[model samples]
Target: MVLSQNEFLPRAESTLARLEGAVLDALSHHGKPSVSSLAGVFRQEARLSPSQLAQALCPGPLSPIGFAALVMRELLAPVDVVLEGSVSEARVVTGNARAPSSLRVTCPLIVLGDLEVEGVLEDCGPDSTVVVLGRCTAWGLQTSGNFLVLGDLVVRDVIQGVYNDESLVVAGDLTTRFLDENDHDVTCYGEVHAEHHLENGRSGDAAVTLASTFLRPELWNVDLGELHHDALFERIQEGEPVFTDAPQAPQVREPDAPTAEELEGLDIEGIAAQASTNARAKDVVYAQRKTGEVWLMRPGSLPLHIFDGKQLLGQGTPPALDVKQRASERVTFWRKRGDLFLEIERFGAVVQLHAGQNNGSLRTFRFAFATPDDAAQEVRRLEARYTGDFLRVTSMIPGRGPLERELANYGGPKTEYTSAIVDGTTLVTRDGERQRFDDEASALSALEDWLAGKRQAGFDLKILEWKPYGLLG
Candidate 1:
């Protein structure tokens, strides 16, 4: 019988452990194991291929250069050309040529004519170098050592320098899709252009134009410029747009707002019953379509709010006074010392606790709790924690700007289609029209259709995410 995944995993792990011990014993017996000796051990025992052996030896991540070197060593491959004598010895190529898919050079290399590399061009060790007298083209170019180009250098995908000892010098223009240089120097005598540039290293003389700058997680010390620390984190986590400016709000022409007469004729109670039956419904209220706009109403035919296709407009009076009183009684707030601002307010059935200080730098924060009692508990916790330090009260609560943006523009990274799931209903905004789906499953199917169309037009498919903000820590 075939073992289940749970059972198979343990057996697989134990087998791997035995294989590792056998390999280790074989290495000890051989003293200095070469590729041929390792192959014999693998064939006789584990029967692992060169690639699998490499993976077993280095399970986790390795630098691109290091990975390529390991693969070459496991395959017992030779370099395209070898330089004799010392490490400083030079190997010269007279004409244009495409380098091997993977190359590791121990000595300096000089190409008099244009050089093209389909894959990676890396160093065997530190101080191993490369020099191109003419233009150079590559898919991926990396160096743990030094590299110089007398002419222009163009990389289709990525070009990076490793460690503080490496230096990249280009006498002419440098162009790449992505450029990463950290703890090293990249000197360009002419212009430098990249689709995405990451620089945490020393800058050199070059006119640089970067379409976007990648902010890696490790480089938190880099200046945020205009963005706040929390805001930056939110943007990255939510997959929101960072490089571009805030998009202009779409000019939406909504249908006329439903008046009291329109509400009187419709069976609002029946609509509410249908909405309540949906398993995904969270809020007390539900929506019904009138004309083209959607109206939000409670079970008792109380029209609380209206959405004009895109924008939410408050039209009706607040919910019943009894409902408000019940919500208010659960929450309590007390400020002991310095001047601070705190208030409990309700939008529809949802209650929000707004807290902040008067200082301009300290922003007002809006916290949405499931119930007023929860909000009250949070308030008490924050008050007691910062009893002596009231000025820094805003630190506990973050601003709602990021959350708001995330809700309004809910789409995959670099997607133009705007979509959001509001109260169990999916709303997709494409072109100038807003399309509504009664359930999330139907909405996901619609989104997939759009992604399929994009894929047909030479673009990768990216489906919309319902609520990416839930991933926030």
Candidate 2:
């Protein structure tokens, strides 16, 4: 049931119209019409069947007008040959006692074997041995010895009388008009025109500027004879390698660097002796240098300990204006004229503990701590480890001269407004009521009228904690 080219062209034109007058009377008496006399007139007048008369005949041995023009072009272009290996879509006219080997045809092919053709191989006789693995358009591609086109041969004009020896590897483009010397060794890889004199044989590794500017330029045209266009353009800009051989140099080396026993077995430490007092040494507890405060040293100290690194705070001591005649007088003061004030106050408020200095003067003094209850338990452990806004005494009344308190941390809302402003115009609200704007569309129309509530009655409207201020010229 292999009939499908619209049912095998109307049953091969109704069995070639019932054996077309006995195949034109046996091609007028044997001019060539014997596949057992057309399979006995297609098994008795076209009832067909010896494999449908060998699928309507045309597998080799054809002559009666090339088998009636290949059965009228296979009943008008039916095409079906695709065979490989023991190929037999046959149409060879003679010459095959089996000498060549690899096959692979695909229609319109005559072969003994070594013929690859992937379609489009025409009239190749003269003991044909075609090899085209694809793309070859020939007319009288007569071969008596060799024709190994791996692709793109396209000869239509003057590629007269074929005769090949060994080297022939096309790989595309070899147009043809005058490549005589039995088509010189031929090693193409694209581009070869051949208008005239490529003298004789030998061109295996092709491409001496594509065999002298397109195949033959009369055998290397030095502008037709004397060599000088800047010495052939400096030998094709120094990349001279036309018929092959110049490719070697590529060996490079450079890698070595890790050695001190491969960087101590890869624990690696060598940026110029990475700190090694015989390794394993770490006693710094705390050390600071870029400006002030962290000095500490209890590991084996020489006295330093000014710690602001989580407070231990003062002891690099030395400036002693008779610090109460020293001898570790650790604290003792009641000076009304040389600062020390500590007042807390907030339970029933009486707050007044002033002490600012760093040159912003404000002072009052009254301190005593030669371990006054371990310095009031280290000032109640720095007011329970200070989490911002400080002051925390909440009841201490021992007063006869100095101790008196009741604070519990109080320092909120000291009224300083001006929330956001980093070149984003200005906004200030926390009830100080100040609006200075010329841009940011009048500070977003007074902040959308204080967020649509237009605030002001009993003014407690908060939400402003921004702080970067500068007023010093």
Candidate 3:
């Protein structure tokens, strides 16, 4: 009996082992053993074969036979697979927890009601790992509750539910029907490029500057032209007002004009009368004989000018207008009608006249002279012969128009090479240096005193030649 019992113990132990496994399987409705959960159930209920030593242990079935394999195989087959987990195929990862199959994976499919993360991630740098979205068999990767991925994320077509956890970043390209009816909702924090269609009622937006517009790197393999400035502005934005510099109008008159008194030698003077009630005591106004262009005098103002009815013409300051005269000379003043007026010398002795009607006068005089050292000797002798006993005085009435004031002052102290009106002649210096002045009268006095000293120094004096200024009466 004892020998029989020993032999039967091996067979009974085998049968009981099978029975306990069957019970665990039956509790699961004979579903496949899962690496995820079935192992725990088997460990708790599993026992050693009858009469086997307590130290001896039994290894359970290797892995869960997925529904397909279980249905296909008549008997249960263990399918334990060793695997390495990672974000990408590029690197190795740590974590004992794993999926049953990476390739032919199986898990629950949750169709998305809206686009959102599955609440499983954190913010990270530009190129870090996010989430790996893919198509798996029914019920494959079902976390009991929520999942968060600290890296980036990706979404594939078969992911049916809203992935509400991680923000997405794509090293390559991305596409989706996130807004299409009956399609899943996918919320992403990144930009969308490449060709794609979105689902119904979905909206997408991005923050970008006008300058952010740029060309795509490659259309497959062809190169694109560099974006033009105008097109670049147009591409990324609209409704921003386009702006450029405005065009300016051209001025009517040149800033420079030749003077009649300068050219025609018309230095005659008379007290002018006002023709316009608008004229004041010192208003200066001149009219051209042919064109009737009236040049008005506004002293100390810019744009010294003559005005026609339609346009004002600039007459830049004329050379000093003041010249000395004992008798009548050309004069400027207000007319009775309030208009400013000007006229050449009236009722004067007519010492001489140049052929041209506009040329006020042609005057010449002769003088005796003996040699003197150099520069200005002949001019000094000539001037003494013409007006040795008489003074030629010109006074400029102050607070007058700029046209006459700027152009008319004369006889300033000049530098060594400059010209000075000594006596009545423009004594030009040899080297053409500029001159300075203490006062106009002082400058004139110095030159005059120097000439007198020259004569007293026993330098020979005699008849000298003289001529009137271009402007004369």
lDDT of 3 by residue, 244-338 (tens): 12322321221122345422422112111222344332433444333333443443332123343334322233222112222122222222121
lDDT of all predictions, in order shown?
0.41, 0.32, 0.24
Per-residue lDDT over 147-216 for candidate 1, one digit per residue giving the tens place of the 0 to 100 score: 6675789976566666776567676789986676745567676789987676855332110223223433
Leading candidate by lDDT: 1
**RMSD per model, one decimal:** 22.6, 32.4, 34.8
| Candidate maximizing TM-score | 1
**Rank order (by TM-score, best first):** 1, 2, 3
Instruction: For residue 199, give model 3's deviation from the true position in Å.
Output: 3.2
TM-score per prediction, in order, is 0.28, 0.19, 0.13
Q: Please tell me which model should have the higher TM-score, number 2 or number 3.
A: 2
- Model 1: worst 10 consecutive residues (lDDT sum): 399-408
List the pairs of residues colliding in candidate 2.
Answer: 60-90, 60-91
Deviation in angstroms for 197 in model 2? 9.9
How big is the positional error of residue 165 in model 3, measured in Å on the Cα after superposition?
Answer: 12
lDDT string for model 2 (1-473, tens) is: 22233433354445455554323332333244433344343333434322333334433333322233334334332333434343334343222122122233333343222232322222233232333334555321323223444346765433433344423335457785545444534456567876543434434223232344432222233211221222322333243322223332222211122123312322121211232333221212222222221221222223222333334333234222221121121111121211112232111111112232111223222233444355455544434433222222211111112121111112245533222221234544434445677775565455545533331211222221112231111
How many residue pairs clash per model? 0, 2, 82
